[model samples]
Structures are given as structure tokens and as C-alpha cells.
Target: MKDAIFEVNNVSFSYEEANEKAMDQVSLSVPEGAFYAVLGQNGSGKSTLAKLLNGLYLPTSGQVLVCGMDTADEKNTWDIRQNAGMVFQNPDNQIVATIVEDDVAFGLENIGVAPTQMPGRIEQALLDVGMLEFRERAPHTLSGGQKQRIAIAGILAMEPRAIIFDEATAMLDPQGRKEVFAAVQKLNREKGITVLWITHFMEEAAQCQHVYIMEDGRIVMEGAPEEVFSLPEKMQALRLDAPAAARLAHRLREAGMPLKAGLLHMEETAKEVARACKLNSKA
Candidate 1:
């Protein structure tokens, strides 16, 4: 088994003056270079969990380890944040400079990277996110997707091994969401960077290697996308919908069709529907 990039053990967190825990006894592991998705609705502990993983918030109880370093230890704060970077919901909030390339260098500067070493890192990071052409452009003039890509490039320049995205696509349009997601996915696949993608979008989660569903600050479900989405009823009961294809596939199965469970994409669902119909016609 690959070494875990993140390990949460019996972790719990509660906001100050809040009546309930924000994260309750949650435990999970993210393997090195793996892509994991966390799905949850508003007020769920997903965002809080992201903060904890990045060492922004100490666990109210239990432990969170990043790259074998305990987050509770103040000494590991700097290295922890370096090893596990974060991209928040609003791209505007993350941008620190007027120029795109300067924004990319912000993290590198804080880490005390040498001036000479910075240009290469900045160029490569922008290239990786497909924003090299816009390196000299003003961030405020770019589209939402472009701005988000710049934010990702800034993190990439820091050379973090893992990234925690806290609903990073929530403020983006569909196109922007697609653009950001694709960039992050490419980094995971090609650069072997571990990702902790937190979002409420079922379609996005469907593409992840593993899915974790959070409700009321606790992990209500965790499995491969297919396994979890196959139970559309359970998902619906939680006031969440599975991906359209998964829901449709479940309905067909319930209606006496032998279509396979956990179909996610529309194309896959269409193919199965046709196959099932053909089988029925022969019968």
C-alpha cells in the first residue's frame, strides 16, 4: 500500500460557542498521489475538515497527521502548510497580486524561494495549469475560470504534495468549474499530487477515485463512487442526489430492468439502457 499523505484518526471539531460539533469523530486516510472527493451540503463539516487537514484549525479532539507530522505540534505548522496547500471557494480571495505571474510568486516568496529559482517554478506552474499565456495579464481582467486557474498555479508553484479544495468551484459557472476541475485532475494524474476535493457536485464526485459523503459533521457514507451512488434512495434520504446517470440507472433497476448499478455518465447510462432493452425484446 502507498504511504498516506493525510491521516485523520477519530477526529472531532466544534466551533467556539456553537451548540454542536462541526466535525464529529471523523476518520479517513488519503493515500499519496490519490484523488479523493468529499461531498456534502451546506453547513456540513467538509469545509471544516479541509481547514483541519491544512493545519488552519487544530482538531478539537483526536489527531490529524500530514506527511507523518502531527498538526497539533506548532513546530510543524510551516511544513504542514507547505506539504498540504489549500484553494478556497473564491478565486478573488486567493489572488494577492495584480499580475498573474506575480500572484503565482506570492506563495514562493513567503517560503523564501530565491529570485532566480522563482521564474522557472512560476513558469512551470502556470504552464501546468494552462495559464502560461496569461502570465503577464491582469487578474481582474480575466474570466472566473482563468482567475481560478491562476489560484491553482500559485499553489502548484509552492510544490505542495497534496491540495485541499474547499468548494473551490462553488462560485464558478459550469464552464469555469469544468476548467478548474480539469486542471486539478490533470495535476493529480500526471504529477502524482494527492487531492482532497471538497464539493457538493455529484457529477464532479463521480470522477473521483473514492467518494466520502458528509452529513452533520460526520461521514455518513464512504466508498467508491459506484458503490455509494448505486444506493440512490439512501442518498435521496439524506437530501442529496446522486449523479443523474446513477439515479436513472437505479430507477431502471427498480423497474425490473437488469441494468448495471452505479452508471455515472450519460453516455454509459444510454448504452446500458439500450442493452437492457435489447435483452427484453429477445425475451
Candidate 2:
């Protein structure tokens, strides 16, 4: 567990005046430099878990830690937030500056980054996300994908070791979604940043190193994409959809095509189907 950057222990949470627990005794560990995709239906504790990571919400009973900094501790709160930055659902809500570079540098400025060093950090952040071309452009003129990438640039400028994306692409179109996902993957691969992508998109989740399926505030299942999604019936029971390829494989199996499950990509599924047909013809 040396690589574990965040640890949650018997965490439970509920609104001060709410009737039911939003998150029940949920626990997990996130490793540094790993891309973890958290999926679930509504009220399944996905967002709540994201909040707990950065000390946005203290556990009602148990403990949550960011790089060993406890979320419930008042003094360590700043450390926790600094270690794990969060990107919320709405990109506009996270944007502050009219210009792209300024917005990206906003976090560094707030943390008292020396004015002399701001330029290099800002430039690097934008360039990393492929937004340097529009550094001087007004954010309002940019597309959703552009805006979201800019928002992420702001966080990256802070140089956090990890990030939690809570449905960050929920508001974007297909192209925008790809842009966001690509940026995230780039960060994980190029910069070695730990990424916790909380989303419902099976395709997006398929890109992760690991996937956790949650339901009714519990982690019903967790594993690699092929291990978890191979059981279509289990994923269906959790109210989670499989990736396009996995779904096609499921349909083919149902149709008596005799293809194997656990197909996370179209190429793999197609190859399996082709093999089945080839063998059938020989028989």
C-alpha cells in the first residue's frame, strides 16, 4: 500500500438534516499514478467519495486520508486539498479569469505563487493540455471541451499529485467528452498524475486501470474492465451499462453467436466472433 495516495476507512456521510445516509460505511484505497474509474447509478456514493478525497466533506464517523493526511483534521485540511484537486461538474463554475492563461494560473496566484515564476507554470499547464494556442483567447468564446480543458489547466498549475473528476464531462458533447478523457489519460501517462474519474460512461471507464462498481452506497464490485464487465448480468444488476464492445458481445452471446464475454473493445469482440464463425464453417 506504499503507492496508495488516498485511503478511506469505514466512511459514512449524510446531510445535517437529511433523512438517509448518502454514503454508508464505504472504504477503498487509491494508488498513485493509477487511473481509477468509479461508476454507479444516482445516489450510489460516487460524488460523495470524490468529496471525501479532498476534505470537502468529513466522514460522519470514520476516517479518510489523502497521502496520509486525515480529512477530519482541521489543520491538515489545507494539505489534503492541495494534494488532491477536484474538478466539478460544471466547467463555468470553476473558471475565474476571462483569458485562458490567467484562468489556468488562478490557483497558483491564490496560493501566492511568486509573480516572477507564474508565467512558466501557466504556460506549461496550458501547453500540457494542448490549450496554449488559445492562451490569450477569452474563455466565453471557447467550446465546452476547450473550457473544460482550461479548467483542468488551472488545477494542473497547482501541481497536485492527484485529481478527482466528478462527472466533469457530463455537460459536454461527444467530441468534448473525448477531449476531456484524452487530457486525463495524458496526465496519467505523461505526468504520472493519479486520476480518479467518477463517471457513468463505460467507454471512458474502460480506459482506466481499474473500475469500481457501486450501488446504493456500497462497492458491489471492483476489478479490471475485463474482469468486471465480463459478467453482463452483474453489471446490469448494478444498473451500470457495459461498454459498446461488451454490450455487442453480450448481444452476440444471447443470439447464440458463441463469442466469449469480457470483450472491452470492438476489435477483440469482432475477432472472437470471426473465430467462432470460422470454426463453425469447418465443422
Candidate 3:
């Protein structure tokens, strides 16, 4: 991929004093401006991979390149992080300042963005996340999704090339999750920022352009959502379930109903099921 924003080449990582590798010989590329998902159950090495991409953890072996800068190179570390910002699972841990706008400006202040230019950048970032209206509000007063959006705003102010969301929506309620996902989707669609979303949410993965499934420190599956979720037995062996609609469609097919393979979303599944029923009635 000539436009690859992140290149993980034969990467492996292990914690100090740990007996096993968290990731083993894993390799993948995220194309520029693509919404990519890395899905796995807990202990699947997805989070470790996210940390390596952001320079929080160096690979024990192999290499990770962010926007073409080698992450393991000491000199390239700062630049790599600047180009590939991270949003972790906890929003509270990410926010620094009391007020929303100030929190968004924290990264800019660290990089010594000119005071005259800070307002414009901060305002834009907040606006991008749909949090401009709460610029003056205190961080603690915001909802979980709002805080996550603020965290994202902080990253956006730094003008990053890509963003890694490490289970960023896991802690939120359904509405909150929807809000944060919508904000991130808007960023990817309108601003053309590349996204790496690490989550166990199958529905979320279905929305991504590409999906990679990790298990036992390796990428066991990689493809478009339809291609991936099509294999129900394989996904089951990995201790992961296919998306709800896909599973339903599979069961219906096994029960002697005609249905298309790899039905991912509810709307599509409903239409297919209805069509099958109508055809059966005609017979």
C-alpha cells in the first residue's frame, strides 16, 4: 500500500519478566484515510499493538512504522507519536485541564504552539468533535462520551495523521458509545484522518473498511467485514462471535431457510429473511 499510514512488519512484543510474547510475528498495514478495526477478546495482543504504534511500547523484535518513521528509532519517537496520536479506554485518564478548551489545548501547549494560534486550533478541534458548545464547561461535568470526544479533540489539536482508538468506547453507555463513534466516523469521512479502532465489538468491526482478528498473539484472520464474519465456525474457534445479524442468518440457513452468506447488519438480514419467507409462501 503506497499510502499506508502504519506498517507493522513481523512485529513482536513481550513484557519484562513475562514468559510469553504478547504479540508474535504480526504484520499488517493501515492505508491512509481508512477506518480499520483490530478485534479480539482480552489478552489478544491488540492493545499491545496499539501501544507499539503510538511509541508507548517498543517492539521486542521487528519494527513498526508510523507514517514511514520507524518507531524504534530514538530520534523518530516524538515525531511518530505526533503523527499517530492515541486514545485509550479511559476518558478520565486522558483529560488534563479543568475546562474543555484548555484540555484540548494541552497537547498544543506541550509542543509550544504559538499562543496566538492556539485559540483557532483548539476551537477547531472541539468543533470537530461536536464539543464546541461545551468549551467553557468543566471536564468533570461532562458525560463519558463527551469526555472521550474531548480526549479526541486534544489529539486532533496536534494535527495528527492518524488516530488509534484503544477500546475508547468500551466504558460508555449505548448512547455515549454512539456519540463517540459518530464523532470519530465524521473525522474519518470529512477530515480524511486514518483510524485504527481496537475493540471486541463485532458490530463496530462491521463498520470498518478492514478487519483483523487476533488470537494467541497472532493475526488469525484478516479481510473485509463480510469476508471475515462469514466463517462462523472459525470465528467460534477463536472464542469470538460473528456479528448478531450474521449469526442469525447462519442459523436460519442451517434450519433450511434460504439466506445469503455474510449478512452483517440488521437491516440487510431482515430484508433477506423476509424475502426468503415470501418465496416459501409462494411455494
Candidate 4:
């Protein structure tokens, strides 16, 4: 029961009154307390899948289960929402209140957290995200990273079982992006929160426990990061980028060097290069 938090079984989706299905027979499962990254180009159904997990959109066919709660059933909708919360791409769009504390308190207020409990909940939420000092500050005054953290704090106040980041770093500068990603990773490591992160960034995708690649509204590949991203040519065919290490190794192999597949980081590639150089010297 604790191993799998989300189960999407052959799910398909079409926008309201639309002709084409946005998601076509897509399915995947996210394990509890795992960091999973979804990668694809624009309109690849990654965003649509994230929404289904959080109950923003119901599946047109098949099922999306969140901790045994079916999202398609209206009775389980509220409970499903409380269990899985979404943090979107734009920080500005997620800001509902002018002040940081109000933003964090918004979700709790909606669930009608008792008056006596609101203060403790809000404070703990901020503290968890390391934003307690900024609780009184205005939302607009914070950095992009800080704003996103507050948005997440709002959801954390609800004590969700998982968090979905839908291209949450797409709109920020490099520093801001790093801040947001770091904060999210910290929470997952310390709090054991399952994270379903959707992004096109290859570097970010490489950090996850597993990677799922979508194409034309379907999952084309799913595997551990090294296994999935190591194939540079295939990733390019899917209109996706490969991690730098994998790409570099691919090029080296193309130039007639003997190299293994799926070297994802610089350190790993460096070791390979040194090993090859020593072998050449011995030969």
C-alpha cells in the first residue's frame, strides 16, 4: 500500500468539446517516496498526466488512482486532492494572496482548519520550507524561487502525500530554477514526499529515480535515468534532449572511441576517459 501512490491505467484525455485526444492510452505508476521525472516536448501529455494525478482533470477512459482513491469518482475527489497537491510552472500564477502567510494559510482555511490549529499549521509549513521569516512579507516581493516555495508551502500546509511539479522551473532564471529544484529535492529527502516532476530539462530529469518520456501523448520510454537518457539518438527522435554526459559519450563513440552507454555525469565520463587513456598507453 505504501509502495505505490499513483496508478494510471491506460488513461486517455480529451479537452472539453475537443476532437483529438490529448492523452492516448497512457499509463504509469509512481511509487511512494520516490522522485519521478516526466520528460517530453510541448503538448506531449506530461502536463495532462500531472493534472490527472491531482484530480484537476478526470480520465476520459481507464483510471487514475491516488492511494487507492479513484479520481474519476466524485466521492473520492476531495480526498484525492488532499493526498496529492500540484505546484505549477509559474510562481506568479500560483500566488493567491498578497502576503506569504495568507498564501500558505489559504489551503488550510479552505479545509476549515480549526482556528486554534491554523497558526501551528501555517508556522510549521513555512518552517518546513525554511520560509518562516518571510511569512509576513509580501508575495510579489519574493524571488521566483521564494514565491514557488511559498506556493508549495501552501500545499504542504494541507499535508499531502505527494507533490507534483509541472514544469515548475521553466519560467525562472538559472539561479531561481536551482533554488526551486533544491528546495523540492530537500523536502522529498527529508519528508519522504513522493514527487512527480514534469520537465523538458534533461539535467533535471537525470536527477530522478526513474524517467518517463512521452511522445505524441503517450509514454514512449520508461526506465531508470541512465538507461533512458543514454540513447542520445532515440531521445532526439522523440524531440527531447539528452543529458550532457550521455550526449558527450555518444559523440565520442561516434568518433570511433569505445565507450559504454549511459554515462550521465561528468565524473563518470572522466573515469571512463582516464581508463581508456591508460589502456591506450599500455597497448
| TM-score of every model versus the real structure | 0.98, 0.95, 0.97, 0.94
Writing each residue's lDDT as its tens digit, candidate 3 over 1-283 gives: 4579999999989999888999999999999999999999999998889988988899989989888888888999888888999999999999999989989888999998999999999999999999999999999999999999999999999999899999999999999999999999999999999999999899999999999999978999999999999889999999999998999999999999989877999999999999999999999
Mark the regions of model 2 whose C-alpha exceeds 4 Å error after superposition: 254-258
Question: CA lDDT, every prediction?
Answer: 0.94, 0.88, 0.94, 0.89
Sort order, lDDT high to low: 1, 3, 4, 2
Clash counts per candidate, in order, are 0, 0, 0, 0
Per-residue lDDT tens digits for candidate 1, residues 34-138, read 999999999998989998997889999999999999999999999999999999999999998999999999999999999999999999999999999999999
Check candidate 1 and list the clashing pairs.
none
Candidate 2 lDDT trough over 10 residues, lowest sum: 1-10
Candidates 2 and 4: which is better by lDDT? 4
Q: Taking the tens digit of each residue's C-alpha lDDT, what string does model 4 give over 1-283?
A: 4568899999999999878888999989999999999999888888888888878898889899999888888999889989999999898988899889998888898998887898998998898888999999999999888898899899999999899899999998899889889988998999999999899998999989999889878999999999998888888888777888888888888887788777898899989978877887898
Runs in model 3 with CA error above 4 Å? none
Which residue pairs clash in candidate 2? none
The sequence of per-residue lDDT tens digits that candidate 2 reaches over residues 10-113 is: 88899899878888888888898889989887778899889878888888888998898888889998777788999988999999999898898889978889
* Preferred candidate (TM-score higher): 1 or 4: 1
Off by over 4 Å in 4: 256-260, 278-283
User: In terms of TM-score, how similar is model 2 to the real structure?
Assistant: 0.95
